[model samples]
Target: MTFTGRPIRIAGASGSASDRRHAIAEFARHYPTDPVDVIIADFMSEFNMATFAGRRMDQAGNAMPAYDLSFLEALEPALGDIAKHGIKVAVNAGVCDTKGLFDVVSRMVQAKGLDLKVAYVTGDEVLPAIQNALSGGQSDFRNIYTGEKLADWDFEPIYAQCYLGGLGIAAALAEGADIVLCGRVSDASPVIGAAYWYHGWQRSDLDKLANAFVAGHLIECSNYVCGGNYTGFKSLEHGGDGWANIGYPIAEISAEGDVVITKQAHSTGGAVTVDTCTSQLLYEIQGPWYYNSDVTAIIDGIHFEQRGVNRVAVRGVRSGPPPPTTKVGITARGGFQAEAWWFLTGLDIEDKARMLEAQIRRLLAPSAEQFTSLKFDLLGSNLPDAKTQNRATVPLRIVAQARDEEALGPRKFVKPISDNIMQGYPGATFHLDMRQGFPRAVFEYYVTLLPQSSVQHQVHLPWKPTARTQVIDISPPPQTKTYPSRQPSQAATHTDQAVDLAKDFGPTIRGPLGWIVHGRSGDKGADANCGLWVRHRDEYLWLRGLLSIDTAHKLLGDDALQQPQLAIERFELPGLQAVHFLFRNLLDRGVGVTTTVDFLGKNVAEYLRSRHVDLPVRFLNRGKL
Candidate 1:
């Protein structure tokens, strides 16, 4: 039925597999006052997908699914509340085994004696097709970022999952399913599907679908749009929200496609302001265009309005038809990786690090040819003169990756390094845990695109007596346009000046750039996107002019310097007073196998902000962030 009442409120309870378990219970606790129509949890990611692939191999005949248990843990406690309130649930936690999860959830419902109609969407796993391609030696599957062909890949791909859209989800909900489980549906697909079902939206309603797409994208990360990863975190602390128990976000979408983002009314911590919304808006995005399986959202023109306490109205999102292709992730066993950290304390930190590295390399030189990669990172610098022991200490981390586990075993990799501790530099002590020196399997992810028609999207309605499953095909749009990797953004209304910001804003002070700027960063495969913005419109021109590709490279410091080819694409979003940069191949082979300490690149923006830059004294006079 078409929605004619109040907006459909969809609450996001979990962002990742490891998100706090109490969030769903929090929503249930506040259900009476802050009721929602549905709750959606997102659990799958490239990193976790790799984990599932590894588990599939390790637990070959295990009866239990290699699904993310965290989602089940978060949802089970709230099931009674959900059933009583008739609140629908959707989650993409069925990483590699949607059917297995569906069976588990069905049994749980039976045990609870609840009448919830559990449904699951599947067909995302397409490993057989990939296997066939491999058998035939087809090289059509090419990496989206590096253009590396599948045939040229060093490792043998054992698992492949294509991203599915929301049509399958909408079908299940429309068929009266109370709970929907999906495997590899786009992160925002649940929200989009719920909206589509609620409003009876058809594929012809491109604009409405686009609006739902944006709303889903916003709240899919749970509290991120509510200040979880906000750069203005201090504001949350001082503004009486205090951030300890940050509230999860809810998207209320109307039939007209307008969305109002809010949180549970009596929820503690975090506020829904324009800045917080903007932070999530700029996160993990590549350019002005946000591509999903169902629709391509044009977010460059999107704007946020603070509409009272803990409320933000999102507007101006446009959309085009879905692209012809959808993203496919292939996972293979990369190798084994092991790491060791040494504390370099007190005087001559650099000299000590050099000596330690020399010793380790000299010891490992016998079998160094067996190592696929080896690197040393000096994480921090010791303080000058007098300070506490912690202050005068920095970690010298050595990470080694190799195809052979024995190559990184204690006998070869660890014993040699650990044996040198006594003979190493003064005050040099290694971490006590010798197990870390043992190699762990690493999974590599290869991302590429497949035709939308190639995916077999299916919805399974288990409650149905007969003809329970329906095949839903999402056809590619008839007309599609290529979006530029980088788009020229609108210029600041206040200035056309090309001069340095110091001339316009006032005298400059050398300090952290974060004082006047706020940022949020995330990863897309191996690439990292750092989006930074300012609080005031007056600061937009200065920020846009100051943060260039060259500036980003310099600010990135050693990470950029170490890369063989440092590629960064900068784009502007003047409406939000933000500059976004996409660093290609920055995270190496994605988060799953990346040796970088940053992992998902969540702190790339923080790293950039920490770098010293000349900030206008006038801006700093307001306050340091």
Candidate 2:
């Protein structure tokens, strides 16, 4: 299965029929003499789904109708051109169900007797399965809502499937598929699978496969790796044409599976750098375990060295053992909740807001007679301790939660708040109308391992011009079921331990002036405001002193200074602090501060101002002293 010649190439067009046609025409015009093996067009986005569904509902009274056969009519001509060129065509941007599309294309192929083998990857449809598992399974998972779990509510998912990996592409290439259609496969899987087919690599060669996978991940998003998302990217001299003619990605892979991600040499304004490439590598990948259907890529290391202006040498990656279980996505019924806001005016706004909220709660008490569970909150006003003197217009928001649809239906619960607004409190204005709120639906996910024996690989040959239509159901390998040993009780104990550990740590030290500390869930990486803090120090001593000997050594290399004073003059403290404070404030407001600080000395200007409030005379000599 070794590919020789010039190498297998793929081009991508924008997701629409028209955009794809234009992009293909553009590609053809630019490479009048060169030929490619495959062309893929992607047109899937969240917004695309919403629009497609909306249109379908208007025309056919069902949103799913948009995915019908008529939708692909515009693409047939372009696909015909690809067949004529002896090239394969793929569509990476489309719906979740490949079977529906296959049925239509299969019928068309039978009628026309076209020499084309089509294959598609579909697994995002498994999200519902994952959701179900998260809700029903007895894994003692954290409640995304109240952050609590109960054994009585344990359940299991109806189905679970991994987002098909490069293996789909591999499967397509193996079966000699002329056109591969896929939904939500990792951006890099197509190229990686194609490379594997061309190189004839074995599954045991994990290291080489990982290198290829990493390369694909780096450039799969196209523009993000080609200066569009580069933080320091400078615009090219060629006006608007620089970004306008940006090309899709191409990877020159080797027999060992090492890849050089690049675009056509003659393509318009594009440059690949370490920053651009690395940013894409870190995009959606959660951690060391990069999951796919076929392989689990354990990214050991990533290094980018300049090969040329547009070429980067990606090397030094390692592989890890694949997961024992496959993850399932399931969607199920959770509960219901709603929020309503009101404007409160007059003196002692906080006090009046609290009193108004109490009145509404009394009115809703009658509805609770019908509902088993009901909860409410009054936002905007600080109630229970309403002694604050600073008075202003307050926006009061009331929210309620309930267990069942019948118990929490909007008609039964919402009108009570509106009915009581002006009866008990003066100057209380209700701004929003009470509308029925959608019931809260929880999506659960479960993880279970299937033995390696259950998965197998096979390839099909390309269709001949006069070949008869064939539908082969490739049997998957025998799946080995290995239930995780940890029970629901043990899992709950572990969660309790984690919560206790956090509480035991007490308050962390306040970040230096102009900086703050924060935490991210879901295994995301750490972020800090230290970069901004270093910029604000007037004496430059705080910034220089901030770095440990090891960090300074790594950052400065051989020129690492022995004394912090050496770099003092080189430091643009005021300018740096200004930028630092700007970002620090933004992050604080954007997310939230995790820890509180007694004093923020990182901003020298702010520190001096604070000192002026306490000791006016001493503030003038503070910097000099």
Top TM-score prediction, candidate number: 1
lDDT of 2 at 384: 40
lDDT digits (tens) for residues 343-364 of candidate 1: 9888888899899999999999
Model 1 residue 453 lDDT score: 64
lDDT of 2 at 514: 20
Q: For residue 128, give model 2's deviation from the true position in Å.
A: 15
lDDT of 2: 0.46
Q: How much does candidate 1 score in TM-score?
A: 0.95
lDDT of 2 by residue, 191-215 (tens): 6677677677766666766776776
Using Cα atoms with residue i matched to residue i, what is each candidate's TM-score against the true structure?
A: 0.95, 0.55
Whole-model lDDT values for every prediction: 0.85, 0.46
**What C-alpha root-mean-square deviation, in Å, does candidate 2 show against the real structure?**
13.5
Task: Give, for candidate 2, the lowest lDDT window spanning 10 residues.
Answer: 517-526
- Candidate 2 local lDDT, residue 479: 28
Model 2, runs deviating above 4 Å: 5-7, 10-36, 39-81, 84-96, 105-115, 121-156, 182-187, 227-248, 263-271, 306-310, 335-403, 406-408, 412-442, 455-625
